[model samples]
Target: MASTAGIITPEWELPAGVQARLTTRAGGISQAPYDGFNLATHVGDNRTSVLANRRSLLRQLVGVRSVQWLTQVHSNWVVQAYGGAVVPVADAATTEQRGLACAVLTADCLPVLFCRDDGRQVAAAHAGWRGLADGILLHTLQQFPDPKRVLVYLAPCIGPSAFEVGPEVKAAFGWASGDCFIAGAGDRWLGNLQRLAAEQLLASGVRSISANTDCTVMNSERYFSYRRDGDSGRQASLIWIES
Candidate 1:
């Protein structure tokens, strides 16, 4: 529930030992387009700048021992994370170890953070439309003991008004997705990514949910949106059990 210059601490009533933060596109040294606080290493930002930004983020994390970063393939795959140099090729990561942070990178795609009510475990998922419809959140939740005992935080993403998609995109979620999409231009639908995510979480028995409703596409000063700008940098959402 706290916000600093470039970091947003999600407003969820997690256990005392669980901590989470999402980075905004501010307070970094990268140049235009990539601009400030871009965290993705594969997004064409300068190597040195990206490394420096990561170090700055680590410093802000206080006692975090290490952060597990994923390759994020837009798939439903979830992996057990241990903070180390080897990056796994998965969309979501979970960890029960204290001081080890799990993180996901995104621009317009949704980033969902999860933590158990008892503060024993934490997870992060990169939930782009492809991954979300494929059940990335559910896969991540499977790493926990029970869905009902987990709290979820949906990060800022491209909002409904800006997320126009073809009918085939809506078909991915089947009949339940119908309410999450509104008619857009001819043959197009304005999809509600957050709503879809929330509905899915609810269906999975997760009742404790909160979100950052800021639209990445609309809020140019605070976020990076791939749909708004073709080539863009990425922000990160991270969760961990504090030591």
Candidate 2:
């Protein structure tokens, strides 16, 4: 596994040769707001800085041959990322080929990582409210031969205490009240993206699940939160198998 300054390494006991890491807002040359380690090219950051940050991140992963980046559209589309090319217009990606890593960029939105128990396959997803409601997780899980053998890691996201949503957002999930949703002022609600993901994964028969409790909105020093700071950088959650 790779380690950048303050990079969050998932604590799950993954199968041998399956490695994953969640990047934080630490380590890099991007300017203020993007400040230290901004890995995204969009959002008005300089291309040079973004590229340099990405290169710095890649250097930490010892055996990773290539990383398949994605132009996320907050949709349920899942693509097979076998080559080095970035999967365009997709929010989720999976791969069976070794040495090719799959990654998703996010700032407050949930980034989910998936791996099969045998370490032959891995996937990554960018699931905001819209993608989550539209079943991006399900779409990613369907790529695996057996969903039951899949293990999931829900990376950092906006917690329920900080993620305020309207009634339509709650209605989209077809739920009025649950542990994942908390009623707020008037018709507003606070939604837990992590819990919602875990519930959906459980319902799909996936038994091994690990999640980080870090709330991006609450932890501005360690993470980048879109809701808290508009026009911010995006961190990444990546997963891959060894060659």
Candidate 3:
């Protein structure tokens, strides 16, 4: 496990046969801004350094599968991956193939992972406001066998208190969003991306779920927050099978 400013590092755990980790600001090769431990190569982090950091991340986990990286345009698109598929571009990745790490990168946006309690399949999705509003989690849920049989684990992200949005962004959810948004000063609204994700999960039929309460924006010493600092590095929320 890596450490960022040492605030958050590999914080949560999935059930048996399922393995998961959320990276903080530590243990990487990138410079400041995209500082040490940044797993996102696309966020202006140098190519070689990002690759090296990713390699280092893999080295830390013995027997873990290579992470399936995504292009992540914030669309509702999701991809299905084989056990050997590595670094495919898509907002979400699902697998019946064991040992392949279904992963998503985030700096305030939501990264959600799901799997059947049986561990025969798994998935990860990148859901920023756009994707979340467009039903990305619901799309991922469609890939599951039984919604209630699937378990959801939310990785670290910008909390509602720190994630203020414009009315247009707030209107994206309409009434379906409900209390996911709270009043912010002026015309702004505080959106809880994590809670919105949970609502979507339940709507999609997922009954079991757990969320990481750490707010990336508020806890700057730990996870990265793109909202707080423009052009920031990204923390990875990843999951893979043990068998």
Candidate 4:
């Protein structure tokens, strides 16, 4: 229930010794456009600025040992976060080891966090439209011991009212007549990614679910949105096991 420097701690009823944080576009030293706390290094921000922002964030995380960031190619690949410090090119990461962090960077994409009910494991995934439709969350769930015992948190992202997509996107999920989409202009439709994610999680036997209802595209002052602003810094959503 702690909120500081635009960082949002997960509001879920999780197990003890597990921690999660979602950073907003505040509290960092990045300049215009990326004005607040931009933690991403690949979004045209100065390397020094990005490093400093990261340092500022890491400082607040009192006992977190290390964070494992991924390349995030928008695919369904999931990897273990305990494989040293080399950042892997994957969409999701999981870890059973204590002190290791599983992290994901996103501007408009969903940052989903997972932790076992027993507090023995944690994971994070970058779930954009492609990744979600391609089964990124499913892949992440496979890494856990049991889907029923895992708690999931869907971090902020583009909301249904602001996320209009082409027919292909809707067709990808095979939901010809579901609440996940609403008819839009011509061949386009307003899609609800969060609802789709929830449905997917339910189909995969995941029962415990929580979500951040904030919309990145709608909340310009608090979040960064790649869909709203073409060139923007990405926010980070991370989860870790306490040592």
Candidate 5:
């Protein structure tokens, strides 16, 4: 794990040469509610600031490949990421092309990262319950040949206890053969986003896995959470090739 300092952000290189990094709330420039380093343009944030923040990140990672961002729709559609014209309505993005980075933005939704040990390929998926239940993880896994060659990392999001859901959410996963949920407060249920993702990754053949201890709801000072804030900023979790 590399320190996300001085604009390089936190870049983590697995034994296989695959590298990743997650942005912090401390960097960049945005306003209140979206203050500090907020990175989403669709969340009612100032476009100028969002662009500047993105520019700052690009400047910091100069000489490396440009970051390939996606327009996510909380769906299960995964697309090949080659710095080409980004497809509309895609929820997950993957890449075998180096230099160009793969990134996903989220406030409360899970930002899942995937990579083959050889470091030749990497991917990022934005998975809210809607996408997760739709088999986004499973779909993303199809891009990689060996699940064991892949590694998984979950980003900050609403915690299970904080993630309250209705029958639809439960039934969606239930129909997918997922058994990670349990009954909870009122008519709601507690869904473990990390566990569900982990099981799905393992089911897809991932041999190595790690889940972030960070929770967007709990670590508001460190990340942005939509569940905690009715409308708030977004944090980006990304992976790129090392120059």
Candidate 6:
């Protein structure tokens, strides 16, 4: 993987043919608020700017032919990506085809990438608290032939210190969540998205797990956080197999 500015390549021990990268809020022409490198078109960023930024991102992806973008709805739905302009309405996508990138957009929500040990299959998921509680990661893992051989990468997201949730949110995960939640003001709880995701993946038999804990809410200069900035732009986490 080439180390490019404003892009993060996972440091996990992935197979030879797998490629992955996560974009930060940098190196784009978007104006203030949306600022730079906003990849999501659903947000209020100008359509032209969003497209320009996406094209710029595509150029950086060396061997990638096309990226599968999704219209995320915070559900557990996972689809087989075929690399086209048609945006599927799903939170996660998987692909066995080379050069077809599977991608998910997020601001503060956790973005998880998956690839088999042999680098034959890859997937990406957008996991918010609701999606996690609803089993988004598990659903994505199901797309693979064997969960045990899949390598998982947890990208930057809202950290425990910054993600305050209500009582219902904590109740959703029940006792399996363990110390992933800490007592907060009133009936709120400070939740750790990455920890919750890791626990879920481990429980599902996935052993190779790596994470980037750079909290999006805390790193205003490098990330976009919806919880921090209401109308903020989104970054993308993508994975693919080389052609």
Ranking by TM-score: 1, 6, 4, 2, 3, 5
Give RMSD to native, each candidate.
1.0, 1.6, 2.5, 1.2, 2.5, 1.2
TM-score of each: 0.98, 0.96, 0.91, 0.97, 0.90, 0.97
Name the weakest run of 10 consecutive residues (lDDT summed) in model 2.
Answer: 1-10
Q: Rate the local accuracy (lDDT) of all candidates.
A: 0.91, 0.88, 0.80, 0.89, 0.78, 0.91
Per-residue CA lDDT of model 6 for 1-243, tens digit only, reads: 334768878677788888899999888989879989999998889999999999999999977989999999999999999877789899999999989899999999999999999999999999999999999999999988899999999998999999998989999998555689999989989999999999989999998899988899999999999989899999999999988
Name the 10 consecutive residues with the lowest summed lDDT in model 6.
1-10
Clashes of 6: 0
Candidate 4 C-alpha error for residue 160, in Å: 0.3
Candidate 3: clashing pairs of residues: 3-26, 4-25, 4-26, 28-37
TM-score of 6: 0.97
* Candidates 1 and 2, the one with greater lDDT: 1
lDDT of model 1 at position 20: 92
- What ranges in model 5 sit over 4 Å off? 1-13, 84-87, 175-179
Question: Least accurate stretch of 10 residues (summed lDDT) in model 1?
Answer: 170-179
For model 2, the stretches where C-alpha displacement exceeds 4 angstroms are 1-4, 85-87, 175-177
Backbone clash total, candidate 4:
0
| lDDT per residue as tens, model 4, 1-243 | 568978988788878888899999988899977877998888889889998998888877755877888898999999988747577899999998887778899998999999999999889999899999999999999998899998999999999999999999999989434899999999999998889999999889999999988899999998999999988998999898887
Output candidate 5 Cα RMSD.
2.5
Instruction: Pick the winner on TM-score between candidates 1 and 2.
Output: 1
Which is superior by lDDT, 5 or 6?
6
Candidate 3's C-alpha lDDT?
0.80
